[model samples]
Target: MTLEEYKKEFTEDDAVGWLEIDKEFDRLYPDQEPKHYAPPISYMLGGEYPLDGVSIYESKKQTDHFHFVTYGFSELYYNEEKVNGEFSKWGFELTFRLKPFEGDNGNPPSWAVALLQNIAKYVFSSGNWFEEFHFMPANGPIRLETDTDITALVFVNDPEIPKKQTPHGEVTFLQITGITSAEYESIKDNPGTAEELVNKLRENNPLLITDLNRK
Candidate 1:
């Protein structure tokens, strides 16, 4: 899309990027009924979260991973940068493929939702960004309810969703996967170990499953 065309008509009419992303998703799962979750009206009015919503789709790809895609990480409005050509403010929306927690039934975990929101908040507030293979320490259990020692997470570009070009800029899809305690320590001791972990993950599981039992 040309800068003039995008700024004048496209972005002006539709401020939501979610619909476009949804179309990309639908192409993968035709007519799938993804359980969509939008924050309450109050949250939109004035709340801690800035995202418009999150959509959770049960994946039949393998191992019953719950695919969580978030909205509001990219330019969701007719902002001035639509013409500036600097990728989306953060250039990526977070995607998570998680194995179902045993007691959670088929319901998506709210903590996963909260984690996405907090990451969005960090980007919007601190101007920090996440990219493929970028890792972060949770300082505690990622899933607070579980005793699993997967305390830190490593980011990888989502395999299913390719980077898309939007009027605002290019939006990349990043997936977060939990890493084992030993991997975290390796990263802590040698920052370069993170790249090794990413390589190992790609070798072992191209999908990057969060295997708590992984040593």
Candidate 2:
């Protein structure tokens, strides 16, 4: 979207951005009450981090993977000046579909939230943004105490939803898909190998849940 377009959008309503994002998610999920967390203070005003809050939703029917979404990244608060750019803040918020490991409680581990917060810190402090087909290493196994083999992550557009344009800018739902250490190295060795990775993943799993045990 152009700068002028974004300006006019906010001029019309000034809330069509983040409000639309919330409405979209609510429409998709219906009336499910997901576990929610919000910092007492916003990072923009000197709190913990950039994301104002995060929601963790566990499917009662499925009970395997958790859906995580961040609120602070995409114009969570009204700021006409900040939303004037091409990308609203970081352009997108992060989402993760994670599996509950063995011996885990119904609640997701605290580490997952910390990981997401750290990523937000990186973007807010570094001024870098993420996009689809962008993959990065978590340095080690994503689950620190777990004996999981998955050590990397790749970014892709969330399969269930498409990108949306907000008054702030365009907000895309960026899902974090875990990859094996070997697969991570392979991508680093050859940058354009994501196509092959996607094809291999599509052989059995479609949602691409982060399977720590996947070989």
Number of clashing residue pairs in every model? 0, 0
True-structure lDDT of candidate 1: 0.78
Q: Residues 50-106, candidate 1, lDDT per residue (tens digit)?
A: 788888988878577788888887766665555545687678888888878765665
Candidate 2 residue pairs in backbone clash: none
List candidate 2 stretches off by more than 4 Å. Answer: 1-16, 60-63, 82-85
Q: Tens-digit lDDT track for model 2 on 127-210?
A: 878888788889888878677778888888877767876656678889888898888999999979876796688567666667
Each candidate's lDDT (Cα)? Answer: 0.78, 0.75
For all predictions, the C-alpha RMSD in Å is 2.3, 3.3
Q: Which candidate gets the maximum lDDT versus the true structure?
A: 1
Question: What C-alpha lDDT, on a 0 to 100 scale, does residue 94 get in candidate 1?
Answer: 84
Candidate 1's TM-score reads 0.88
